[model samples]
Target: MTGMTAEVMTPKEVETAKEAAIAPKFVTKGVDVYYAEKQALTNVSLDIETNQVTSLIGPSGCGKSTYLRCLNRMNDTIDICRVMGDILLDGADIYSREMDVVHLRARVGMVFQKPNPFPKSIYENVCYGPKIHGIAKNKAELDDIVHTSLQKAGLWNEVKDRMHEPGTGLSGGQQQRLCIARAVAVQPDVILMDEPCSALDPIATAKIEELIDELRVNYTIVIVTHSMQQAARVSQRTGFFHLGELVEVGETEQIFTNPKDERTQGYITGRFG
Candidate 1:
């Protein structure tokens, strides 16, 4: 399949191509966010293409995670966090008062920095999302979703015989993959990951990276990572954030080899974080 192009074209040509090309699954425009009175993001605009992995990289407190949370409205859980501007999913603004937080989260799922599986069994953990979202009509359907999700996550072979075991009992890497399987159970259109491999070793990290590549065929993925190598390995596109602003965004190869902005160059070149 042909990927989306950043080539400049006339308005009419762009419109025609846009119609022919797969539209962005997510669009954020002029998005500003604040925690209490302190601004955390400033006029951040971007498009997350469908069926591709997009990585957000930068120094700590650069608003990468904050911007990610905004996609699924996870910031709504924080009382002091306020957001302005628009975030659209398939052309509808998700921040609108009419949007349902429960439904929105199901459509846009998340995996945290540390794997936090439920106390339940592995099978239950994978089935929980489908159960909560009412995606499964019955026990048979729930089992099918659980099996499919685990297979997609590349964990089915490892844990298929131990479905009744507690998810917390698995190794760190296994638990992380279990979390990914749980996210997939709901059949989300987009999956948001916040430093998903920060706790794992290199081998586990490699496994997760492979899973990320496979997952992009079915879900739009947005990852916030501190590891430059990890970002380069997994993402199709990369966004560099600095001081609460999105400094640059381009193909992963371009961002690494030839950054357009000084700040991005500094970050990637070991001059600064």
Candidate 2:
């Protein structure tokens, strides 16, 4: 046809563009947090889209985890922590009195920095949430949930024969994946992970990263990590936090290669963090 230019798009690129056009899964506006008058997060606004991985990256004590806690109202557990702002999940206010904290948390499940599997069998650990939430109507139903969750977390094959063994008996990586299975068993719409691989060995870390990539296909995932390389590798969108503030947020490649803010550029480039 004539002289023309065309842009090549990969599968991930196409998915990212599709999600960008949809309404975000969660929207936070002008959120602020204080720990007994000492501010931990400044006015922060961000959006999380569905079926995608969004990463929060920054140095130590930069309020990344604090901001993540806000998603599921985890901050409310602390007596000294106060959060003020509008955070909406699926167009409803998560902080409203009309919302039940228990149900809200069920909808937005969390996996912490360290693997904190229950002191129970692996099967029990995965079924704990569904049992408490009454998500299963019978033993057979609960069994199915447990099986599917473990399979989704990529741990079923290794632990199927040892389901009755303590979750702590598994390797560190398996324990983390077990915790992830527990989270998935709840049938949550969003999964929040705070440094899910911080304590794992390289092989374990790789497995967790692979799981994260797969999990994003069904659940909206948000991860906080100190590893910039991990963030670049896993996230479609990345947010950079600095000194209790969100310095910048954009596509992962753009944030890594061409940050608009000086603070973001500095952090990503190792100039200062």
Best by TM-score: 1
Model 1: worst 10 consecutive residues (lDDT sum): 1-10
lDDT of 2 by residue, 46-108 (tens): 999877899999989999999999999999999999999999997799999999999888889
Those runs of model 2 whose alpha carbons end farther than 4 Å from true positions after fitting are 1-21
What does candidate 1's lDDT look like per residue over 134-176, in tens digits?
8889999899999989999999999989999999999999999
lDDT of each: 0.93, 0.91
Off by over 4 Å in 1: 1-21
Query: Could you estimate the TM-score for every candidate?
Result: 0.92, 0.92
Model 1: what TM-score? 0.92
